[model samples]
Target: MTVSNNSLDVAVLEWCKLMADRNDKHHWSHVVTDAAAFEGSLLTAIGMTKDEFAGYETAMRRYRDKFIAHLDSDAEMDIPQLEQAERAVAFYHSHVVEQEAEGIDLHGLPATGAQMATYYHAEERSAAIRYDAAMQPVAG
Candidate 1:
């Protein structure tokens, strides 16, 4: 059955939100990961058969491309923001935790990292949960 692109888009965004919620408050990776999964689920909900979808080699590649494209396509950020983000992972050498920890009071640092990590990790987990719910045998 063909699905409405608008409806699918809404579903995709909703799943992305769910993913964001799952990821630790600070962990952004999970959001990306879940958004990918959300994309995959949208594909399936419209009926990509197990055999057809299974051919994708664990479905990891499917959403990964979309996620990267999404990052590349963000219109709000200018070169500077991209540069800062690049610096974050590259120059600043900030893992999600370190980025969140920078300049925070010591007492709050540990708690904040813990919270963010939990949030980000949760996003990944939520994806897995939904994947399982989708009844697709996950290869990895």
Candidate 2:
């Protein structure tokens, strides 16, 4: 196989989109705060306070804005911890999706965004390996 690496990775951008703060971000907002729901935030279920998790959310937003959303070189910063981001996503699935997503039929699907990305990476890797093998020259 000639090609050393081949993979599509847009996880950070997608994760940032989910964690972003916007009026249209209904599900995320509902999980993060009680602004839209009469019940309190689901963040507590994950053993995190709004203030505690806000930093992670903010980091994702900044990463999205400065890097993925734009080429703002001056504002670019380090990505947030993957474990923190994945935890937030998992919490959303359990607290909101399992509780409120009636008739949505989320069964057989990965529970978190990180798990979904794993499938994408695996598929891309398989395709790349196949392509590399196919392109190998026949022995003279």
Candidate 3:
């Protein structure tokens, strides 16, 4: 892997290299457990199953390969679902990073970023309703 003089080439090549599945020890499988990707283990963490993950990965690959990396004949392309990716990352963080790597405390964060997002969204809706009820017009 020789270093390229062009900045853009460096960035693109780095991504391509990372995405390639040489299946060596550096591969993601070395860290991500089947149970973490599929089901609950002793950690009791939950995430997308292998099939579900594959679907998301396929969508992303199409987007990356056809949409971003290069242009194809297709006028439209399927987008990767970010929420799905987020859950997978969250699972990986808890399953591998926190468990395997030492001294990384994520104590303040929610189990999933989605949980915090949904919680705040719901809170906004609830607050609006409460405010509306309190500010209701009184008829004498």
Candidate 4:
């Protein structure tokens, strides 16, 4: 079975939400805590058991580290902080795109007022991009 990038991203977002649950505190506690919960769920989501999922976690950790390094090299901010910020941005963008594209209205979505506001902001910006692109002159 083929898993799309969107699915992976959605899974990551869900995992992040799980980590950020009121009882979990994975965000303020540590990255490993989030990763551990994410790894297990993601592996199972893609079809794998705990033992078989360990390799996937290792690979994901390596990829995340590389991404952090690249972001650090490109920006002045701390790598870990940048990575976390970027992940949140990416997750928010993905959810907004998914919901809007599916003709789903997100007004007053439950459990996340700030997040929904951010989604609306992103959707407005994205809509402007689409309008601008449509208005642009095309070369023959």
Highest TM-score among the candidates is held by which one?
2
**Pairwise lDDT winner, candidates 1 and 3:** 3
lDDT of 2 at 25: 55
lDDT by residue for model 1 over 3-96, one digit each (tens)?
Answer: 2334344443433333222444533434233445544543445354545533432222223335422555534432111222222222112233
Pick by TM-score: 1 or 3, better one: 3
Please list the residue runs of candidate 3 whose C-alpha ends up more than 4 Å from where it truly belongs after superposition: 1-26, 32-47, 104-140
Please give the distance, in angstroms, between residue 127's alpha carbon in candidate 1 and its true position after superposition. Answer: 1.2
lDDT of 2 by residue, 33-140 (tens): 354441244465556677776776787677667765786867436755666666656666555444555555667776555676686579868977888778889999
Tell me the lDDT of model 3 at 22.
Answer: 30
- Model 2 clash pairs are none
* Candidate 4 or 2, higher TM-score: 2
Candidate 4 residue pairs in backbone clash:
none
- Which of the two candidates, 2 or 3, achieves a greater TM-score against the reference? 2
**What are the lDDT figures for the candidates, one per model?**
0.39, 0.59, 0.51, 0.45
Candidate 4, residues 1-140, lDDT tens digits: the string is 12233434444444444433324544422333355554454444445566644444444444344443243353333212223333443443443444323334544353253565677679768866876777788989
Ranking by TM-score: 2, 3, 4, 1
lDDT of 1 at 116: 52
Candidate 1 accuracy as lDDT: 0.39
TM-score of each model, paired residue for residue: 0.23, 0.56, 0.46, 0.28
- In TM-score terms, candidate 1 sits at 0.23
Alpha-carbon deviation at 28 in model 2, angstroms: 2.6
